[model samples]
Target: MTIEVNNESGLEIDERAVLDIARYALARMRIHPLSELSVIAVDIPAMEQLHLQWMDLPGPTDVMSFPMDELRPPSRDDEEPPPGLLGDIVLCPQVARTQGAEAPTAHSMDTELQLLTVHGVLHLLGYDHEEPDERTEMFGLQKAIVDGWRTEQGLEGPSPAPTMT
Candidate 1:
């Protein structure tokens, strides 16, 4: 998969780590390797504008997903998976920092951002948590993917789990 990250939040972040997490999540979901994805980090104003415009919420949200092509992972029975544009995952670092502080998980802002990135990608992959069962399935898979990535990076394991929005 081709993951593109554009940081316009005015806050410095580990861009490579974000790309790595996106790649790992897509790979775990069995998304086609040739799929394209974009991760954009924006300032609070940008996020708030998007939130109000798209979601019609009052303030900036941590993350938002805009899917394109509505691509789904190829089934095991399928012979070849076709390449497609996955979608755009918009992230707000300022919001993420605030949410990270309040999160039950005692992780750094980077980890929180990583978690949100995974969550956004899952949304792109057709995962939703609006219902209890959906929440269980989506969050379970998210934690597994994050834990696996953290282990691979030799980082300390996660703290208390953060509630997914």
Candidate 2:
């Protein structure tokens, strides 16, 4: 799977770290290699505008997903995906920074952003948090994925991944 990340935000985020995070989650989840997702980092103002325009919200959000709907698996004879574009995930680094500082201590903004990318990708794969049970399931999976990354990197102590809203 190709996890293409575009850093539109001014913050200096580690691309390799983010990619590793995505790769780890994808590998863990066993997502098909033909699948792909994009992560776009944005500033506060741009996120605010997108949130307002797309979600009808006034405040900037930590992350927003514009999923491209469910994928129709290839036929028995088909060799690859019809289109690799899974959809786009827009993230606000400044908002994430503010939210992360106040959220879980082990959930750093970088870690949270990586988690958000996975969450967004899952949404693109037809996962939703409309129901409480679904929210729990998704959150559990996300936490485990992020925590796995932190653990593999030799980060000491518990790493509390971000929860879905």
Candidate 3:
């Protein structure tokens, strides 16, 4: 998969880690290798504007997903899946930092961003958390992906209930 990470948040962030996490999430989800994805980090103002325009929310949220082709994971009975644009994952590091500070589990800003990146990618892959069942499934998958990635990277696993806000 073509994973592009653009850091325009004006805050110092590990762009490489963001790209790696995104790639790992896509790979774990069994997405096509030729699928294209973009991860953009913007300032709070930019995020707020996007939130208002897209989600109709008042302030900047942690992350927002703008899907393009609405690609779904291929099943075992399916043939080779077609390549397509996966979509864009917009992130607000400032919001992540604030949320991280208030989160029950102590986590660094980088960790928060990583979580948000994975969550956003899941959303791009057609995951939603609006309903109780959907939230359970989405959050479960998200935690699994993140924990697996952390294990692969030799990092410590987060709390059993990592904050998803």
Best by lDDT: 3
lDDT of 1: 0.86
Score each candidate by Cα lDDT: 0.86, 0.74, 0.88
Error of 2 at 90 (Å): 1.0
Q: Estimate each model's TM-score.
A: 0.94, 0.83, 0.94
Off by over 4 Å in 3: 77-79, 159-162
Count of backbone clashes, every candidate in sequence: 0, 0, 0
Query: Residue by residue across 62-107, what tens digits does model 1's lDDT show?
Result: 9999999777766685546678999999999888788878876556
Order candidates by TM-score, high to low.
3, 1, 2
| Candidate 2 lDDT, 1-165, residue by residue in tens | 888889989998877777787778766665567677778899988999999999899988888877664654344544454655667888887777776777756456776677777677666666678899988887777778777878999977655556446
Query: How far off is residue 11 in model 3, in Å?
Result: 0.1
How far is 128's C-alpha from truth in model 3 (Å)? Answer: 0.2
* Better lDDT candidate (1, 2): 1
Best by TM-score: 3
